[model samples]
Target: MATAVQKITLSSSRDIPFNKLVLSQSNVRRVKAGLSIEELAEDIARRTLLQSLNVRPVLDADGAETGMFEIPAGGRRYRALQLLVKQKRLAKTAPVPCVVRDPATDILAEDDSLAENVQRASLHPLDQFRAFEALREKGKSEEDIAAAFFTSVNVVKQRLRLASVSPALLDVYADDGMSLEQLMAFTVTADQGRQEQLWQAISDSWQKEPYQIRRMLTEKTVRASDRRAVFVGLDAYEAAGGGVLRDLFQSDDGGWLEDVALLDRLVAENLKTEAETIAAEGWKWIEVAIDFPYGHTRGLCELDGMAADLSAEEQGTIEALKAEYARLEADYDGADELPDEVDRRLGEIETALAAFDDRPVIYQPADIARAGVFVGIDAEGTLLVDRGYIRPEDEVPVAEPEQNSDGEPATVAVDGAQPSAAVVQRAVITIGGQVAEPEDEDDDAVKPLPDRLLTELTAERTLALRDKLAITPSVAFQAVLHKFCLDVFSRYSSYGTAMEISVRSASFPVQAQGLKDTPAAKAIDARHKTWEERLPKDRTDLWDWLTALTGDEQAALFAHCASFGVNALYEKGDRYGGGATPHTVEQRIADADRIASAVDLDMVEAGWRPTVESYLGRVPKRRILEAVREGAGKRAAQLIDHLKKGDMAKEAERLLAETGWLPEPLRMAGVDQTATVDATEPEGDREALPEFLAGDDEESPADDADEPHMIAAE
Candidate 1:
């Protein structure tokens, strides 16, 4: 055990003159990789050299050592140092640290070179990340680190972001508990608590992914590119102390704005400011919203106004631009490609022409006094001002003064007869744009309103009315039953009017924005979803499955399916029609009353509450006040009576939040026949089911006039 042991000898180390070193043919490195020579040279200039070159002394033909030594390894490092010498920053006589092999050693130069290049391990990625963090902590900017390491600035930033993740997760990553991609996901958010929590939540589940982490962290946020954020610029949002969660590792659609509520408030405030500016333009009313639905002014009248006239100089400039544009276009018309200058000149001409079109419109003082304007943001975030809209109630009345030939004021005839015209032709006294039906020449009889137009208007009302009715399943079922009975009985067909009794769920012709988010709408969506899940998927299996349902399930399902068929629409009554006559409408009402009495459908009890979008917003000021007065009492109505319709609607909504007041159209028209019925009677679960399809996933179509159809079990 005490026997002498031989000591291992490593390759000898020595300093070699830069001028004496020359290219070694035994060197294995040839192709460029990692850092290029130029970048490596820059790095060397910044911080001497990281690795020393491996070299051996050159041997002459007689086995004698030559003055110059041939290099065997670390060729890149040699090139970098040589480049420094060429640039005069380093001297040729400067000695570079190197490892030298004994001239008599049996090891080949190529083996030494290969061993120097391959024997060492690459730096661990985590070590690199920590190194970046250490450099940042040591007062070095990311830019400095990137330049010194010969990498991109973004790469430096990404590494810093990775380093900033929670230490606990970082430990897990270091221990190989997660992949690099997953670690990258956690970097989207800076909150250590959130990062740790999300990892813990999904670590055991199969759903743990970087994208999922990002989604969960930003589910409540608005995208930076969202319209609301676009309207409220990101600079303003951040100034308001709102935060944005950005992903440095992946494209996040410009990242998510973390404070949605702040964004909404900013949007509202900015919109209000925009409204104020437009209001100063002498508009009778100004409507401010993020967006106005197409045909938002359906009931409003449009005023005709003239565009402002162009000045003489402006007109002459436009003419000149037009001439230039024409010349450029004509010259390039047949060319395969337009010349850059010609294209640029044509664009200039177009821009000049467009400036003229932006001139203001001229309106009469009277029209301006009564006309309203809509101020909203367009899809591109540009301010949009739509002017010259007149409400129906603002129409002016034609004035007439009464004076007789005897110089005495004449009174209008009480009998509603018109005076004779100058030619003795029968004078027609019509007002309010009501045109009486013309007499048929063949029969010389007064004809009724055109059946097509009447049906169209009735159809409009029927759909709106039906939307309210379909939500009341009890009422819908009974209404359907009433029609079924009428069709079967075939009783008294005499003295009928032209109205239809069809309950085809009429498509909503118009709806207020965000109406689908109301409590009632949400509840309906949830209910519909419940049924959708409960029912069998295949239509062929529906009947068998329905028959197999329990009594309660059957009753609920029946009510739901029947609601689709319940059409309580009031089409215009024709004296001679195919459907709803005046008499038929009366009968339908009587039948609807019976059903309302039997099931006791109270809209207030069916998860419906009045909100601006659902009710108050669409009505006039008078209607809003009336609802508040009835629901929250007169004091509440008085508090907001002085406000404009829009403001009044908002105030009224808050006041009536707990009040179960419904619009007259949505109220049960049937008499209280169920008040005296036995309380023990079974009303089924129709009352519990919501009015529309249920669940957040069940989106109410944006088009209110989407084809009228039921989400039936079939």
Candidate 2:
């Protein structure tokens, strides 16, 4: 059997009963209140309905059309139309357009209606919660509801949970911009009443307290075992007098109640009086002075007091006791035995000393006590104190003055004059290869001379010798100085230098038997070789080599040579060739000059001469010319131009010709060709030609081709 497809037409209100437009009371209120349906009604009246209503057709048992389709969605729109009819703006019997569908389609229609309302209308939290709950009542799960609206299940649940909050708290939250996290924390209390109570408390506290304090209070309230009671108590307390607690603690104002001013003054006066009383009785208790070494000085003081003011009989007994103690001390000087009677007396003395009460007469060292001195006491009734006195034997003594050979107080001498032994010892200087004589003529004369004079004299002598040797000239002053220093070193060789060199050269024995190869032994061997090579026979050519170095080069080479020792120069492969073979000092000097010239030119070519002069050292004229020649083609011209502007142009011209550039013409003109080009052109452009070679036309090829032209199409 085949089935026929029936075409169903959407019917207007004319084909259905108008009374069927009745909607839920909630929907009707929403429409009348200008909330849900007003905008839709205005849109429909201004512009024709852009969308048709979706409704499920309802039929009676006879299948006759008793009522029109009942709208699942568009309830608000349906209500708006009814309102328009009542206002006489729309026809009382006017037909409304709607799409009819099966009864089951009401679910989708309802969902679509909800989405439309949600998209167009801004619902309150309460309204959102109601919508979610209504959907839940239709047997929809939280996940289904969330998925239907493209939201998280948790969000849907939260909205539904908001239905449990009191309207007052919700309004407060909305007004204060309180975070949802804080509100959620407050809602931890399962009981709705308790949550409301906490919410109110938090709201009230937030208005009066600082943000931190309110946060603290909120945290405390939420975690509290009995939140409802805590919140209620807080609210009641705030209602009563607790609102002023913060002000009372922080501010000086005491409100309208007690005499805080008088109380404060009285309290201050009492504190002052109490301090005075404490100060007056500060020394009421005696503190014994004792130290670890002097275990109980207080006990000794007590013993002395016990012996003071005794009667004749007591005095005799103490004298007898002292005699016995002296005898015992003598006996125990070499022996460790003590007489029973002496021991008994000592015990009695110690006991009596411990029992003495001199609190009234006792005085404390005021400064020491104020500085907080501490004393130790033991259960044996021993008071340990520090008397704070240093014995003479424990002190370091000042040295005594020494007398002269004549056994008389001698005068100290200055400037190589004879001085007392005291002056000589104290001055601590060598004079004539012996201890210097101290001056007794004047105290100031006995004092040591300043180091500046010695430094000045030494520097003058050194500079004079340095100048004699021409150390800072072609020959490295450092090399010459090193050679001179080696001569000085030779004089001290027998004193231990030879022995030290020998010891350093000797190989270390392994396990005290055989020799071992080690760096120390190698160094020692190297030193021995150096020492041998530095001998007079080996040093014949040393001066010649030293004289070969330039002042700066000599300084650097000498410093490097000196690092290995003066003897190192004679050793094989020692930085300078062995002292046996002499390097041509003149040849080395000339070669160095040539090298320096080359380096200087390299530096100038690289634009580094100024930097080199600033760091390594200055270059001589020959080197400067060499540097100019190396960079002669372009940079030399620039240098010449720079020189021409200054007084050095004549000198520069000589240097340029020496470097092999076209100096004669440049010198005649007194201007550098490169400088002229640089000054006029600024930057050279090879692509640029003479003015005559430039085109006169300014219009571009495109502009010229803009005129119409017929062309054959291929």
Candidate 3:
């Protein structure tokens, strides 16, 4: 009633002489790939034959079996065995395990070879990882595994690391739910729970880039290249029992430091030790910190000191370095490029000469007794010791003249009616129509207005005068320009003009990382340097040099100096809680908008763009979505909104990069908005505006409702 199953005959197995197994032209493999023949031969010598070769009997064209066999499949294995014979590691007559096929079969050798190569499944990565881990658990060292498997120790370690990941994630990896690269990223952290959590979070998101995974895993950790970590050497941190997370798969820039608190402690201890050593040099005090705000020395006085003179031997070394440098330069005078060793030797000479030039400064004992040093680490992780800064309170007080009974200065008379040189000056002082010093008030006479009342009255008059001066554009500009010039050029003057205004370059204590290396910052620095080079070296000559400059030059210099005073950075609420209120902060931003509008400031043109480190990664998920919505449109925002904070931020960065969309603080008020609108509004969605943007309805409150108040403060 049923069709019978036909009985199939299996290929017979037997031992064959290595010398008799000949390569067949019907072999499917041609190009070289994994594991060279030499390495394979070495592997065979260690493990013997793991897989039996497939061999077909050699026929004599008469359809009869010959004494020898030809390999249709496992050609590489045959070659490896032959290589062992050639090396005398194996006997030519040594028996190799193989499956022998009949010479009378209808199957072609090529068909057998193709089927053997194509039908077989290569070992799964997960399986290999587990196998390596199993070997590791059995007391095999990473090196031993590598040696046995013909792989690198790093490869073995990577495989073991992969195996150590969360079993749940491992199942996903085995099912092809994640890429090998993504799995590799999870190895950055050893916490299996965290690995599983991250996988679960991004499992549904469309943005599971490896970098994003690595970022999420190591978000709380500090980069080993961070200044603090660099200062507290990685070796020292490890010695202190602090852990470090390294990414073997990617260039992690020395990887991340897992224990941030421990690192900070080590850095502090190291910094304090350095400060104490510097204190031994007779400095009055040492201010230690990880970093000081820019312009920290603004109000302080820097004492001038002479460099220590070179000793006889030091002087000879300097001459020798200089001579060697000159000889090398002359030897390669016009060569396209110097020889590698010659170039290196020249660099050494230059460095030696520079060391001689950067001699230790010799400060006077009196100066050292009053001045202090600022000890911190620079951006490059080098010890930064800014010495000889004299705080205002530490400056030597100038002796004051004797005051009369009525609090008036008693000027010594040089002659019958003239005052001494101390009292002789260009300007005469008057306060509220009275002399600089008022005569003693009399009880019988009507007392003059109180000093407080006089101050109030003069303040009102000062405001009125300012109003008038502001209307006179030419005079106002001249007055401000004159003040700037005097402040810049009259650093050493004992007396100054009556102007109360000053240009104080603002310092950013809290700024984004890499702010100093931004294009705008670099351009400003280059411009400042150019002007500094053009200016006179001596302060006394500054005024004369300015006077000689043409009108355009003067204006350019004025603008450059004024640019330094611009402060538009967003500060935290109540940064100056006691001194500045929220209203003042809001007004400051309003005024900055005016200035920005006047200059037509565009942050996008200044080379600012949304980057993870600069903005997206630092903000909350809701804010990131909001930024993406505004910059890259709603569709793009929705695309990544479901992602976790870390993944969303990275995707948003890619989406918003070219949109030229800026945050509220960076956008200038009164700037043309057509370009921004066109850039942000998706094509064909321009006319289909959102209700809020179209002014059709009131917008709902944001997830972070406090943002409005925070915005006002910023």
Candidate 4:
């Protein structure tokens, strides 16, 4: 009789009897040696096994309680339980849930137990390779294996690569604990023969000198042809060998080595011989050319000396050639001169002079002698008389006119009339006066006028008297005198009684004058005074009043005061202080507050309540609570109302459909239930329901195909 089937729960650990758990020998061996076994056990002991174990119960022939179960996967859990038991951490009677299975059924074949094991555990490379082979043998595609094992196709492919590598290398990895990465470098040689050769090379290096294995593998030079041919036929292999040979030795001497010293000496000797020959030929030509009697050095040196005195002979030959070249060049240079027409004109002038009665007199040697005058012609062709005697009577006396009957001297009239002495005197006086005015002025008058007077005048006079103003003036004096005149009479005279009264009323009394005392006056004063106070006292306050006004206020005030000619105030007067218009400042602050409010509201509306809460940390809790209550009462109600009325559910369905969360049928169902139907059909028209009830007619072959007779004819 068969033994009774048992139901049992066991904690995963190495201490669990191996006979009790039905783990594969490969899986059992891997659990015993895996690096993470201890950690997995510790985690299982602490966390009560985060993942449940998948197992199937064994049944006896009699179908009685045997109190035992066979684990389909979760070998790691079994190992962890063994460890826990060894460490005295688990009870032997713990219950584990499992599916019951018939004893005759092949557990690995009936259920994907191995696939589930790989999906859950990090399998060793060797184990994965074996698993991949087993799956492939079972006619499972790589993609199916990948999906079952929760890995990429390429990852499965790489793990399956063990079969492609040399068996010798796989054995080396299994026996010597070689890293999969290091083993991967050898996998590049997929050929059974090449892989075997490479594997032997690696094995020999590892055994004789383990440290040299990495260096040897990295330095291994496989010809491109060989790399390609490893996966192809012998013809490809031979072609690859030919390519390697050609590439390796195409250059002279195979480019493998060069005799550096010999090459260097050869190049140096060729350069030296060429240089010596060039020098010898140069010297021979120089000697032959300089040996002539009529050459440049003929008079300076004899032919023997010419050849021997190299420097002098060389210099003389160069000079002689240069002179001859210059003479030849000068012949062509006349081509650029004036044409013959110009020369003919010059000749005509000479001929005409010769025909004149004067006969174009020339001062010859005899004429100079007869005249008893030594005349010398200078390089410029001007004759110079060194000395000449003059007769006493030959001198012409200076002419003088006798006074007419009117006592006025007889004078030649210019331009039809002799100007009167009085008229001339007046003109001379006017012109002379204008020219001499600045020079003739009193020294005191020439000194610059005070800036006060100059600045207070109209632009016409101000510019006229600009040079008269002081180069530099004290700010206090300029402000009080030039801009704010103290003399009431002068102010009244320039701007009339009304403006003078206004200025006088705004001004401070001489003894009591100060900024505070003239509050209204200072407020209206140019804004430059504030900048001046910030600066050293030496600087001028030119733009004070203008700076105090905002752009709009300035424009408005300019427009308003234009009729009264108040623009001249800024043109002539210096500024006194700085301040912006109240309107503009308040407007800017309000605009900033609006922008900040908008941003704060945006954050709050966007579900950034936490950020808003952080910023309102300084706000009173009661005020915050009040604000939230108000927002909930109004905005929340409105939002809910909007969501209820709007097709938000439909929109959500659409979004879900787009993201593939909702399948096509569910999405279409939602649309059919929510969307309106066509009104053209009667409300009770059951005939329209045929298409919907009959499924899609377009996809049905009976509806799509032609009649049998029509098909046969075609």
Candidate 5:
């Protein structure tokens, strides 16, 4: 049984005059928001009205329809049109599109207004990004797009960058799978493949922080502030066809240099050029490197050179700069802050004065003939040239008289008879270096046992003596103290000592960036400075100073000095199989372990956290997972095991940060490996993961082989 369908009719629409349309009191919108009336009016002027105004016929008190209508919805558009009219941009009688509802309709004007404002969905950011990209593709410059949208050019560029991300990642973003900040972080890098790869790695992780995303993206790149980059100069690097990655959203401190190898080459070339210029001074040799180990001048003789005299013109310039500096300082003497220009001028004056103060040193020709120079760049990116160092082998030889058996000086024969070839060879060898005297004729005597046998016997005796010394702490201490006393009290280091103890502070030529700023390094430096200030200024007074100290003070000083010689660093073996054999490496670690055990050294207590830059970031995903498993527990390891190498390392850094977990190399023998766990908690409870990590136990789907290698989820 079909009934006739009732037809529905929509309200009639018409172009109402701008003057005839009036604002209704029933309009719900009162507070101002979004674009201003002027901007909206400008937009309407740029591209006519986008939507029709909802209006109703105005009725008199007697129920008669008036000639005008009242707008309930689209009040903003009405105001915009009125503004245009006021500005004489649009006529008062302009035809404004409208939909007229019946004067007697049941719907209230407020209802219509509310419905119009609430029912319309705001555009998604992704849409805006895509729209901007589309505009750019349509032959519009970034400035054009910005002007069209009433935004800054930088904003337009950022949107474009976001749009340029991997389409797959964009899809994920469109699905509300990531935040705007995270999307912005991905724009730090432009490799579409890398963007997709990283997203897949962190998409399921619980710790997908925006900063983590940025760090992972730029981990392999060198920052512009890096010493190497600073030394090579970013402008010059770019001129050499190198690319730089910049972050437009946040301050990147000059961004990052994309081509690290190119930067290194430029740095090397510039350093070599500087070295060549310095070599013009007639140094016997110039040792050039990016950086030298600390205390590199040990055992080298340094020449005492005088600063070069300034030229007449230079002296006048220096005086002028100093006078200018004094005038500026007096002008701003008590001010809270100086004006930028004034401050800048003051800085220039000071620098000019410093140039005069740091005049080049003048060395004697004789010293220059035997001395060498060390050329490298300091941490501040300035060329550092250390001159007048004389190696021991380069020193002038002193003449000595050959004595006869009767204790009188022997004279050389003036006769033409030349010495035998063997005698000549011996004399030539003596000129090269100190040589062993000719062994007394012992061929007839059952020759002192074979040289090799004698060496073996002596080595055995040395081992037995060391074992005995180890048991007698007092004797060992006295022996070390005696060596130190001689070193300090004796004027010449050439004096011989029975104990082969020379406390040479180890230098870390190869180390992580910012190692000097670490807490451990800082504490050691402060301690060294304190001792340096307390020591006697003169070497001759050092013996008296030591004698006046208490026993405890002496022991403290001894320990401090001995600490400098501790060498626990691991260096790679030579590639050609020449140095640092596997056995030697093993032995070094073993000895370090023994020393660590004696001192009860806990690296965790030493403020060594597994940060991304220090440890995790440099290692593989496997090592990161292993660290997490050992430190945080198997559950925490599983949480991030699915992430890519970068994300995995970052997440591992977070999980293991306070756990006090250390790598095997940093762990001491016989120490509890899992001591990082909270001591008050029960042993069984330490494995419980953090609350944030407690989530659906179900494992996420694994990524393909292009992702980091994954362990099977438990």
Candidate 6:
């Protein structure tokens, strides 16, 4: 048990001549993997051999040792050295360091090779990041570091960014508290405090998705591709003291501008310069806005202007283009497809021809003096000048001016002239335009209803009729079929009293904002697009196309065409002017209800809710209280009644978010009572009375004698 231990000695290492080393058959590496021999050769040439090769002395058949040695492990390094020698970069007799194994040892060459390759652990990613950082700190440029290692400059930069991440977050990453993707997302923002704050906010929630993190980090910044940023070029933005946030790890759509306000100011300044240049054209009171609303010119009179005539040279150029296009088309008429060069030439010719057609218009001197232009920036960042608008008051009188019998001027003129042709140059701001067209004044024999009232009434009637006709598909089909029969069989029957039935869609004179982007609208558009793609291109082929379809297909088409007839737009009924009687709107809505009940339609299902911006905030304190009372409970309503309108609306919005309660117009067909909150008072507690009805509404402290009352109130 006390026997002396024998000391084991390592294999003797020595510098062997490169030419003397022979490749070992027992090295065991066959297939190629990570680094190629050529790259390895270059690496060894750059920096001499990193690890010593394992080798044994070669023995002759007589058992005497030769001068040559055989390599087992580090075979790749040996091959690299061999390649270097072949390339004349290394001398064949140059000395190479290696550990020489004893031929009498029990260890197998294959075991030694396997152990050398497998026992090494890979460098940790964090360690690599720090290594890159240390290299940078030691004055190695990113490019130099990238070249030193077989990596890209961007890869080097990413590692450096990761290394620069907060020590705390790096620790978290090292401990496996976050993913690589999340860490990359944090690189979008360099502010450590902001990054940590965002992480804390989302770490407890499920909102920690990488995209969500990126969005929150850049929420206050403007994308480089945004119209405003694009208009104010990045160079100009930077020159104006604005900073940009960039993501080197991924495509960020040109990255984000850090100063949104500065970008906006630059955009506005550029727009103003463009407007000022356009204003030099002698327009009458030019109006400038960042964007004109859809119906910005609703009631304004547009002056008819003629497109500028092409000059002789321009006309000749267009003719030449057409001639060349015709020659090319005829030459390739029988070809299955035009050659790319010829196709591109044809496109150039077509564009040249269109350029002449799209020339700017030339307005008459008088119209230009009396009309104005609306200048704005288009979505493409180009100046958009909508010319030729005459405001209602600025419209010139067509009738001859009244003559004064005593030779006195008929009208007062601010310019002190003969009234300046009955037209005026003025700047009148049309605030919140009334879209409906007005009626004639002298048609009292049967005075027409006010435009707004008519629009409101017709809107409800249109929706009701669409609902009724949609559900009664058979009737709709019969009506259309009967009309078609009359058109084909009796061409002379068009003048009869029988209604000329056709789908006349009602335009949206007034619509809720974002009506086009709603889910229902998108669904309808997708369905229309599907049918449009299936339909014939030529109108003449439509009848034949329809006739070839099955009955089900025809009915489906009919329903699709009919659905466009729905119009439920709400408009102000003109309380200040002669309009349809007040009850007419109420009656139309009631009829719509009857039709809606028949079809079992629900506005809630059609995508509508009482949000703070959409409904609750727009209403008053009283309406907010009413909603809370209906949706939540009387006690909830009383609780918020003491708050101001803004606070009350926000609270009510939260209260009604899940109740599914709707305003009168948005209510479902047969729904009467609103859903209630699932809550109750504790046992032995009294119901809370309305603040008005309670005697202790003043919130006064109670006396000893009144303690019982106070306890009851509580």
Top-TM-score candidate index: 3
Per-residue lDDT value at 295 in model 1: 38
State each model's CA lDDT, in order.
0.65, 0.38, 0.69, 0.35, 0.69, 0.68
Candidate scoring better on TM-score of 5 and 6: 5
Q: TM-scores of all models? A: 0.58, 0.17, 0.72, 0.18, 0.64, 0.61
Tens digits of per-residue lDDT for model 4, 1-714: 999999865433322233455654333333355446777776666557566555554558787645455665677777777787777777654554344445444445225465664556565678778889889989999998876655679777777776556776678778865766666655443455765665565453312232233223323333322211222223433433422211110121221112223322332343334334433211111111101111112112111111122357555655565565555556556677645765565455555444332322233221222122222222222232222222233223224546889998774332233433211100000100111112112121222222222222222111111111111122212322422353544643222111221222211111111112122222323332443334433225535756876776554443222212211111112234353233333332232222223222121122112112121222222222222223332222222222211122222322222222211111111122211122332556344322222343222111011112210001
> lDDT by residue for model 5 over 1-714, one digit each (tens)?
999999988999888888899999899999999998888888889999988999988999998988889988989999989988888989999999999998888989999999999998999999999999888888999999888778799999999999999999889889988888999999998999999998887786665688888887898799998877888888999999998888988999899898987987888788777777776665666787776644567678877788899889998888888888888999999999999999999888878787778878899865665678887766677787888898898777323447899998654321122322111100010111222223223121222222222222222222223333333345556656655776787673423233435665444444444444444555655777788879976789999999999987876676665555445444553557786554454444455454445445666665567876666755455556667877987667777865656567778888987888876555666555653333444656456655546544333323211222111000
Give a tens-digit lDDT track for model 6, residues 211-266: 76887899789899876777778999999999988887889988999998788778
Give the Å shift of residue 181 in candidate 6: 1.7
- Return the lDDT, model 4, position 62: 88
RMSD of each: 21.8, 35.0, 14.6, 43.0, 14.4, 14.2
Counting clashing residue pairs in each candidate, in order, gives 19, 22, 0, 33, 0, 1
Candidate 2's TM-score: 0.17
Candidate 6: C-alpha RMSD to true structure equals 14.2
TM-score of 4: 0.18
What is candidate 1's CA lDDT for residue 258?
89
Model 5 spans > 4 angstroms off: 30-32, 58-60, 64-69, 82-95, 168-189, 193-220, 247-256, 324-352, 380-382, 397-608, 611-650, 657-714
Give the Å shift of residue 529 in candidate 2: 52
User: Model 5: how far is 279 from its true place, Å?
Assistant: 2.5
Ranking 2 against 3 by lDDT, winner: 3
